[model samples]
Target: MDKKITNYIIYAVFIVLLFLSTLFKSFSTDVLWPKDQNAKGSFDGIIFSDPQDISGLNVTRTIFKENNKNLVKYDVSFLYEGDFGNLRILGNPVSQIFLPNKMNPVFSDVTLKGEYNKINNALFQENLKLKDLYKKVPDHEFSTTSKIRVPLDKEVPEVKFSMLYEPRQITHGLKGNIAQNAVFVTNARVESFRDTTKQEKGIKNESKNFQESGYYVNSIEVINEKQIKSISFESTLNSIVFIISLATAILLIWLDKNKSQVPLLISMMLSIMTVSRFLDKGATTFGILFIWTITGYLASLLSYAITSEENKIKTRDFKRSIAWTLIFLLVNIIVFIIPRTF
Candidate 1:
């Protein structure tokens, strides 16, 4: 076999192996970025609740990939006519996806699904007043409904709140999302607006809740940098590059009669890119970095050098590649460490 053709075949074979390994890593269930199929084994961020919230409290966030971006659809839940009514999602609203406005967020994705307990608007000839609405509806802890602000003369039926004394399993389907580094915050109070003593309770309670001990806020992380990167450049991008290079190498071996350096150059470039991506993430000790740098540089050089054009080694090129590899590896290590120090 001609040495040039053998080199192309061997390089194609190496890329084929890389493609196979990456295919496994990207598609395996245990690997990262599951539902985001377009970018499997990539950095698709995480959707999680705040650490302080016991059992994630009322926030239920599910992280999935959609349209090549990490989409988080979460149900921000609280008691009926309760905290979530005054909810405010405050943080870095950097995401270009579904984010709720700061004030009047309930209107963003409202789903009114509960009734007022012990209140009958049908019995009254005139529309129920706010006082009647408040006094007639008994307190029940389990009813879940979207908050609706009606005029003082509006009927309880107009509110369409499904309130009851009986316990019902809540399907907190009120969905909301925030971009990376943002939070879902709510100025929810522990008290209900069952106070019928003042007709102004509806207006006053919110202000009171905002000012007093009843003022409480809970935060749920919408998405953050700390999330497990499901699809990363190392895993998915390299896999793609490997596929493209493998195809090119096959074409060169079968069709291109001329001896070309493109195949070997691709192999070397890919090795450097793969090593760079690896060093971009994960904690790497000096030992790991040393082995990785040496392996990456030597493997690429040897892939071409062993089947040299004249069957001789390029010692200067090998040394230069080693020096450049070490420099880049050290630079990556520094870049990785500098951010964590702060």
Candidate 2:
């Protein structure tokens, strides 16, 4: 076999192997990026009986820890059609209140207020009072503002909001075998509203009911910027080590192709690979080092095969190359597949 042809074969094999290894490296898990900036969960907008009457709605939330407990405060604003005075807003006691920890029964408090504004009929009704329009005709819009505070036991990575409605009831009763003391109960009657004739006659005769309503701003993510940066830095370090190992392997193999320098160059390559494995125990770094070690050994064996004058020595080098190639394949399988599978 001509020495020039052998040299080309070795270089071509090395280049192909290196290219394939790098292609695999591109898909390795060591590459890192920001993964915490997005929220994950089902977040249907706030529920309403009628969804079309609402012009717009906005909800903004702020989360923080207070008194050893995580708390989220929500500020909500929405525009609706109809008279603000006659709108009766009621929240479902069960679903409207959110608890961070399910064990606690305390319900969060919610407050709401609405402001009135006249629409197109304001010019003709400029002298008319708002109180007089209660029964005449609906010609106004209202902007509502609301706030809610929810308590949580721990910080949530993401938040999902939904509206739920269900029937609930409470009852109290006691039973005992022993005699019990007698108990007495009392009841009181209260009168709430009374209207005067002048007020009733001056009021406009119009329906003041809400026609429709809707909700928006359903989900948000709580991101940890510091943790994302740490992951990115670690990935960058791993990539740098991989690049350095690849370059070193190519240089060492090219140097080892010379007959006189084979022993010294192979020894140096082995020593460097061993030291690198110890320095960085990461799978990516180890895999690169293992690949370079195999290539170095193969290059040394090929050098011996071509340079030796005796037929027996050349045959021995050929057999050794076959054995080393098999061993390299087995080690690569274990390194690349085992860790990723489990």
Candidate 3:
């Protein structure tokens, strides 16, 4: 094959792989919101459930405090069946009963059995900063975790809890569920409310959608009041980062083809991928590049031993070059594990 053609093919392959992986991992590609639909609608709150338990709306239930402008509660119970007995759920701070006056939503109480435990507002705020549970929020408090641990030692792992929140928007009715990580809830009960609520409190059933009762929640809504006129700050920043990453990728590919700086190009591309992952999704731009530059350079020295040209640019070992490049590319693909395979 023509040398130029070979380079272009390699460039195209790398570009496609990186592009798809980034898009798959980046939620910021769309409007900067938690949920998919963007309109003025009251949010019924979102919960990030541990994927191990395979919890969904079918196994979950929700109920709201009967009072308005007070507290909104999520009554949830999970049937644990996974290795990680410690169930972890994080609430997206942007999507719930925030204080009527402030943009903050603080968890007032977390109940496991019947007893409610008080969590410090500051500690919860601090937890959001650490990515141990999830990503770091940019401007202010992003997400909060109100964990209710259901120990495996218990005879029956059927755990129940009521989480109270200040009413920002009234979310009632188990309108629907969103993936294994998130489930939305409303304030009112559904047709199966009686049997479901029998496990907890007595509630009336108004909806017609009936299922064999066992924790069926009612009422979840989306109010189309909060709408964005222009691109948000974070969204704008993400866009910029994306543009930079793409441009840098192109530049690195071009340089690699002409100058044959294989290790340098691979390292930089790896770095851009990490930085583009703003939420620390996997890693960062500089951090990833640094590791790649250091490690790939040191490892790729074998290429020199395979080449006889001492004049640097006099002769090209296209076959050896392709092998080393493919090796690095394959390593990255496997390491990052796309959809996050950047």
Candidate 4:
């Protein structure tokens, strides 16, 4: 057999193996923008009694599951009325209670089945209101819904909110074994009223409870940077990266029909890209920005260099590339450290 032919056969086999390896590898579960199939928004009304009130508090909190399917965006007028109690407002003032105006937008591709606790933990981390630890209610801590003001729209609209509550240290009169030092929210009323030219407060009946069955919001807008355009970019970049890498593989095979190395290189590129893509996805899903950014940058550069047509493999070039890569890695490390330094 000709040596060239044997090399070609070997490369073909290696390429095939690479493809198979990549095919078996698991992809990342991160939601890249618009790919959220289960994205949904809700306007929750939580009614419970203020824990500090003596007149028996009733509170209702509302949260909207802002999903991709829903076209409606939240407005500035959207107000969240917490159960009357001495609750610490995290970043914003109670008087200027607005939805997290600059909060990061989350993709809704993650599921809620069996991972309810994990999902809740993720939400708690992402949401500022939850971080405030608003009055820990004994055993039933999960019952009390934290009111979050999420941005639905840019328009500075005005909305009306009225509540009747008695601020009393709750759980005092409850029977024994009940959760201690409790706060209750009930009878919530949410209305989306428009300002008449005459400045009259119109009555709108859009109130609901948080505990009602089949009632839960999955997404909310917390930031302006989370515009639809940004979401689109994230989705497009992920796709383009994969496609370009695959195309490079195909091109290499075509150009070096007799060289077995071409096929092997293609397959290797595919495997690497697959792994990198999965890692990026996982990072995005878990909110590990530093890892995702650094990994993605490295993967992009390595893919280009490994598959580039300029086939001059000088030992010096290889060392220089390795050095540069290391430098970039160090840069990422420095970036990760800067935040902690402050």
The C-alpha lDDT values of all candidates are 0.33, 0.33, 0.34, 0.32
Over 244-265, each residue of candidate 4 has an lDDT whose tens digit, in order, gives 6556655654555424343434
Q: What would the TM-scores of all predictions be?
A: 0.31, 0.32, 0.26, 0.31
TM-score order of candidates, top first: 2, 1, 4, 3
Model 1 agreement with the true structure over 37-114: per-residue lDDT tens digits: 211111111111222221222434343445565443434433222222222232222232232223222223233231
Error of 4 at 100 (Å): 29
Q: Which candidate is the best by TM-score?
A: 2
Better of 2 and 3 by lDDT: 3
**Clash counts for the predictions, in order:** 13, 6, 28, 46
Q: What is candidate 3's local distance difference test score? A: 0.34
Model 3, 1-342: lDDT tens digits are 544344445545544544444443332322222333322222233232343443432333333335332234455444445554333233433233312221123343352221011122222233212212112222222223343232332244444444454433222111111101112332213222221322212222222221112222233222222221121343456556656655665554455433445543554354344443453243333334344333334334422321212313222444555466566655665654342332
Q: State in Å the error of residue 145, model 2.
A: 27
Where does candidate 1 stray beyond 4 Å?
Answer: 12-238, 245-263, 271-288, 327-331, 334-342
